[model samples]
Target: MLGQTAQLRYDFPFLVRTDSLSFRNVSLADAILFTLTVTLAWFISSSVCQYFRLRHFDGPLLAKISNLWLFSSVNSGRSYLDFWQVTQKYGTIARVGLNDLVTDDPAFVKHMCNVKTEYRRSSWYDGMRFNPTSNNCLSTRDEIAHSALRSKMAAGYVGRDVDNIEPKIDSNIRDFMRLLGSYADKKTPVDLGRKVQYFTLDVISDLAYGAPFGFVETDTDVYEYIQTTEKNLPMVMVVTVFPWLLTLLNSPVLKGLLPSTKDRLGFGRIMSIAKDVAAERFKLDVNDARDMLASFIRHGLTPTEAESEILLQIAAGSDTTASAIRSTMLQMCSNHDILHKLRREIASADIAGDIISDNEARKLPYLQAVIKEGLRIFPPIAGLMSKEVPPHGDTWNGVFIPGGTRVGYSIWAITRREDIWGADALEFRPERWLNNSPEKVKEMESTLDLIFSYGRWLCLGRTIALIELNKILVEVCS
Candidate 1:
């Protein structure tokens, strides 16, 4: 019995010593070193997994391992050119980030954006939200919800449901011309870009509400809208590169830092204006009204939804059309031959008054070609517009893309492809549209139409923008 008790006592002391060794105190440096080692191991493993997943696709070495490459490119303020350069070097399908692939393939873009496409918008679109608490049509990622919202707002955008769209447009054009005339009289160098912006804003505002914002009449950047947008848009675009940042910004804690309707300048002021206009419009009987707000109301949009969409119209509608105008004008000014051709076409066309009718402008073949060519060279919105792959995965040109990958369009590269638009694609040659065969023209037209997007995601503002373009170019040139 004594021998057995001695053995138990010895074993217990040994076990206690082992336990004491296991719980030894770790120094601060040791703890930090251990944490760093674990982090490094996790990072390396993660990079390896990501690299192998898309190792078949070629991109910058850094891009294959991190999103910092993309963030840096976007911050350079010429991301469109950088993206184009990437595709030019790596062919149609090129990796731009750890999990992001961009393609200049029109067929692939169309397939992903088709009416019944399974691809949903990527989380990148979350950065497009104007209101931190709300998702505008541009930021809505769910296909069903986007479609529903589009349906409610389609009538207002289509112009058939709204009254006096052209007259309102003509009125704004008159105001635009008068403003330019004053500039000409003064013999001062006018900033055509700023004036063009004013014209577009006035036109859209007149169409949306019953009256214009008087940007042309006042001859200034109303509410500092231009300055604010210039400063804020780049930062907003930067946020899109990091999905987690968007989540953090939109979260309840940080949401208070974002723009609100009460702010006295920039987007918030515009939002405040929209809210006030919407409030007044909502009090009227729907049957007695004829503007876009009324059309939205008649088509079953609630006051809050209408307010959001009206703000969208003012922001998106004005800027895109302004870009189209400025680019087309710049192209014409740069090429005397093209400018002469356009002027000749406008001068020869039969028009009823100072402003050319949309129908009249459409009949002018050269003018139409000029518009198309301009849009091709400079697509207004150079955004990535990334779409997420379906859960089951997708294959393009026999390359298997893993599920949950983000595929964005290289819009600049696509528009400048030598194969599609011929060797002179980079040049602003309107003759390409006029010289092609009917089938060729049809193909080119279909491809160019992608500037407004395609299928279920086709832009609702397309018709309105076209009307503005069709009138403004002819009137200005004449």
Candidate 2:
């Protein structure tokens, strides 16, 4: 039996070889020693593989223990810099540490999701636990769990219930424009990114949790807490990428060693709120549908289930939209030619003086192009999407992405690769997306990064997001 398992294991890189070989002829005590010996061999070989360079690549310094630290090091703002630099030197793929592999290849995205839930969503997101009852869209690590919540929320996402979102978005944009106009009137150069963050927080919270978390409408230090929270997301995601280090970091005495205790407390506040809402909303029934809170109640999520779902929704929905808006505004301001062209396109539209209707906004082409360009340049959640390597491929592009090894898609790298996007790939040029030359357009999309990702795991809120964004961009810019 042991020999058979070993033979099957050899078909994949994730298997660790044990030197004790077998206990078939051994006494119970001797077999124990052999098991210990095998464990030690496995550890030694893995450590060596983690630290030393092989024929194909030299691992990054962080990679050496990046997995050990579980990427919770709080230094990923700079780590991102190291990652780009290393991937550059090592070519497109590099060994990220003991157990992680990050690849920037475009085709890799499709390849990674090949298996059904091949890789779990990671455990550290359990940090999202605001309360025991809290269960919403984002925190559930199981694909099966996510599907159940998504099905309940499908009315607000795929079906007519989301149609109500259209009016809600219109009102939010009106409020957003009013806020921005006041800033512009004072000649305030507000951080467009931060303001967009506040705007989306207000919008998505209104949609998801039944009202604003008061990120924008309310004046409190909680707003500051919200800002700090987003700035810490890349770091938070790092913890997800590498989890074992989190256990090490959480050691009682070592807790004080990290700089993100504020994040810990803020998450507590978020969970407490989720619990409060879930407790209150659980009493309501199906006909009570006023918003998403009631929708979940009707859909039959227990109060605790609803709370968790809320956590997931807020995490997934808010920041990405805000980032897209920030990137769009910056991209527009930076490119005068495209900017002027877009401005002209806006003015040329007959709806200029009229309240920009969503339907009318749909008529504008340049704005749509600009939005796509923004996603390409600065995708808000431009983090990696991970998967478990299959046994057949020990590694992609030469490095062994062992079967149990978690692999990631470097979103920024794929979007900017010369082979994928053309020589001016990194440039924020919207016109490149225009379908002028059939050959050129085909070349561009063959690199086909939707930025929202693709196929089964693709984002469901995409259509709603586009509608909300287009309405606001046109109304405000017009």
Candidate 3:
């Protein structure tokens, strides 16, 4: 018994010493070193795994790590240029994010965006969603839902129906020209970009809500419209990479805490404007409402649905059209010969003094070419329009991309391709689109439509936008 007890005590002491060494004797420095070692190991293994996963494709190292590369590129306002550089280095299919590939190849653009393909808009669009739970037309990702909503809202934006809204556009354009005249009379330089934006905002507001925001007459952005849009747009680009962050940001508590000026400019405020317009129109029993909201309601949209649709129109339509207008104006100012030729065309028209009708402007070849050139040179939404590859996986430009990869066409790159448009592709030249041969012009038209985003998700406001652009160009040149 004594021998057994002695043996037990000896073993117990060894066990205690081992336990103390293993659990209780770890110093802070040691713990830190151990943690760092594990972390380094994990990082190396992860990088190696990622490298093998992306072995078929090529891109910068940072792009393979996380979405930060894309987020930073876009948030820094250099995505267009950055895309140019990356695509130049990596060729057609370059990894812009861990799962995102951007291609400049025109064939890839057609195949990926084709309606027959299984590509749908990626989660990046979710960043633009008003309510994380609910979706407006612009932010809806579901194909069937987008189709149904589009069909419901399609009649409201038909090209032929745009003539009915010509009066509203003319009124705003007259006010805008008068304001510009005042600026010219004073011999003071005006921020033409801001002025152009105000004009578009007023015009679109009139169409969407039945009344203008009064920016032209007041010569101010009364609702701080430009400031709000500027602040909020960056967030949309950021969340496109780190989409999980969207949920946290959109959470009520985080939103309340951060509380940016942009947050206040969300769908809630847009919806409020929509509600007020509807109330006023119904209260006054206004005769034969010609505005977009009325058209939406007439075409079977519920009150909430109508409000959502108009909100999309006002938010999406205003700034983009304004950008195109400003870009065209800037290009014209820089190119004196183009401006002179266009103005001469306008002056030769029989109704020179009167506001030119869209139909009449369409007949003016130079004007049409200028508009096409402007659209190609500065597509308003000049960033990646991401689409997710289908579950079956697909091959693009000879590279086999696995299923669920996010892919997009870089319109910025494609439009600037020197090979397609010649050495002067970077230069703003309208004649490229004015090819004399009908077949050649038809081909060019198809190319521009691709940049404007063709297929099932074609821009709905295209017809109205073209009409506005035609009239505004005539008025400005005159």
Indicate which candidate wins on lDDT.
Answer: 1
Q: lDDT of all the models against the reference? A: 0.86, 0.63, 0.77
User: Which ranking of candidates, highest TM-score first?
Assistant: 1, 3, 2
lDDT of 2 by residue, 1-478 (tens): 7877687556632333455443234467766887999998988787776555332555566566436433543244554445555567766766666666566776666655543535455454454433323344554556787777777776756545543676677677767777777778999776656667767777777787667766555423353557556566665666566555456666778765443323345655565666677787665554746576676667767776876666666666777787777778777777778778887898888774345666777778788777777777876654555555554545455455445555666676667777666788879988887855778666555544446666546666777677767876766555
The top-ranked prediction according to TM-score is: 1
Sort by lDDT, best first. 1, 3, 2
lDDT over C-alpha atoms for residue 221 of model 2: 30
Local error of candidate 2 at 58, Å?
4.9
lDDT of 1 by residue, 246-340 (tens): 67877789877677898898888888888888888878888766777788888788767767777788888899999999999999999999999
TM-score for each model: 0.91, 0.77, 0.86
Instruction: Give the winner by TM-score: 1 or 3.
Output: 1
Candidate 1, 296: how far from true, in Å? Answer: 1.3
Runs off by more than 4 Å, candidate 2: 1-45, 49-58, 61-74, 79-81, 114-136, 186-189, 219-223, 227-235, 245-265, 288-290, 350-359, 390-400, 435-450
Clashing pairs in 3: none
Model 1 residue 229 CA deviation (Å) reads 0.7
